[model samples]
Target: MGIQYFSQVLIFGSFIGLLGWTITNQVGRTQLQVKSREDWLLDGTGLTIQGILIPLLQATLVYWLYQYLLPIQQGYLKLPLILAFVISFVVIDYLYYWNHRLLHTKLLWKVHQVHHTVTQMDVLGTSRNTLWTSLLIVYLWIHTLFLYLLADPTGYLLGVSLTSTLDLWRHSRLIIPANTKLYQFLSPWLILPQDHAWHHCCKIHNYNYGANLKIWDKLHGTYYKSKNMPSIIGIPSSLNLFQKLFFPFS
Candidate 1:
């Protein structure tokens, strides 16, 4: 719901490692291709002002709007608290999947392209979209409605943070540990790095748009389900500095 508390940060960090380890063990090793220093940072200095500011600002704004504009207690859905929390996550991920696909659309690519332009995959790559492109998903509106109707503020933020943590790890280059049977069971739904690396690969063959789950992609035609074939990563063309800087408007 806000900047992470220390305990939340610690918990989230542990979760991040869990996700990274899963990917490193399972799918990432097979995709082992060396990336250049330039590739590491969008060809150099990868963390743009926009990239850094967008998520922080948007999270703040959206959380605030949800808390105030759509206060909870507006209605009761009659679902149990736990069920409401679970349902909220599904709804949020569902909206995000479509919004993510929309960014890949031709008309919107000029803005969204800044993110896909990165040739490397990592935790940071998850937040690489243009601010406007990220904003288009309207996650807050979904949160607001859910909070107002069914979830409490704490539960809603917990759901969002859980989803965010999942997204962060899936974008990383880590693979799941092959030795563990438990990893295998968790890997499929959790969006491991190998799963998302395919999404970042060139030609965008698999797409794999969901952050928290694979259901949306599978349900829609965008799901790419395979571990055998590899995808080429990055955008078709690189944008110059000015182009990236002006991406939201372009």
Candidate 2:
């Protein structure tokens, strides 16, 4: 949480649409609007609390975990830049895939449900989880831990930036033609907006669990490929902010 981190967030938020994916498949995009200005405020408040504050507070615990339980001497090993970059990307993506899959399980779905409460996918939707749930996100904790121990700042930047870019793009209303060369090139390899939308789809929610790559889903037999849109968006068992924050115990 230094100036560099904020700088990257600012840059990533601005110009996320530079890739021109937001306008594809217009029919599939679901537009959501707030009924009042206060609704927007509430949304912003929730995002800040869960996405920023809680994570910042929990980082102290992560530091302690690193210092005591997971300390490794690999930082001095000085991995090659190219090797570190590729390994970090692969490692994070693989871990994220399984972790995302875990979120869909019956036991874990309650903790992860806040993210699916919104009917529409927007960039802000990325931070829709509750404070406690956000703190426990497998990728946020594990990925940072890996970079802390094994990767230099430069290698970590590439891995984090690439994933961040993919994440922001995944939440957009964009669509890539499944039959086009670009879609084929990126599909089952990179996460396409349509692929992610299916994950949010109520009926087909069990499929497309990969965060960055379709490889894991395919390997685990959860991969689904089709031009169809989901029957509906948003989980049926959605929770309000209070329930989201203190859910199951609320």
Give the winner by TM-score: 2
Global lDDT for candidate 1? Answer: 0.61
Quote the lDDT for 106 in model 2: 90
User: Given candidate 2, what's the lDDT at residue 154?
Assistant: 64
lDDT tens digits by residue: candidate 2, 110-158: 8877777756666556566655666556655765565557646566556
Number of the predicted model whose lDDT against the real structure is largest: 2
List runs of model 1 lying over 4 Å from the truth.
1-79, 144-151, 228-231, 248-250
| lDDT over C-alpha atoms for residue 199 of model 1 | 81
State the displacement of the C-alpha of residue 136, model 1, in Å, after optimal TM-score superposition.
Answer: 1.2
> Could you tell me every candidate's TM-score relative to the true structure?
0.71, 0.80
* Residue 231 lDDT in candidate 1: 47
Clashing pairs in 2: none
Q: Worst 10-residue stretch by lDDT in candidate 2? A: 27-36
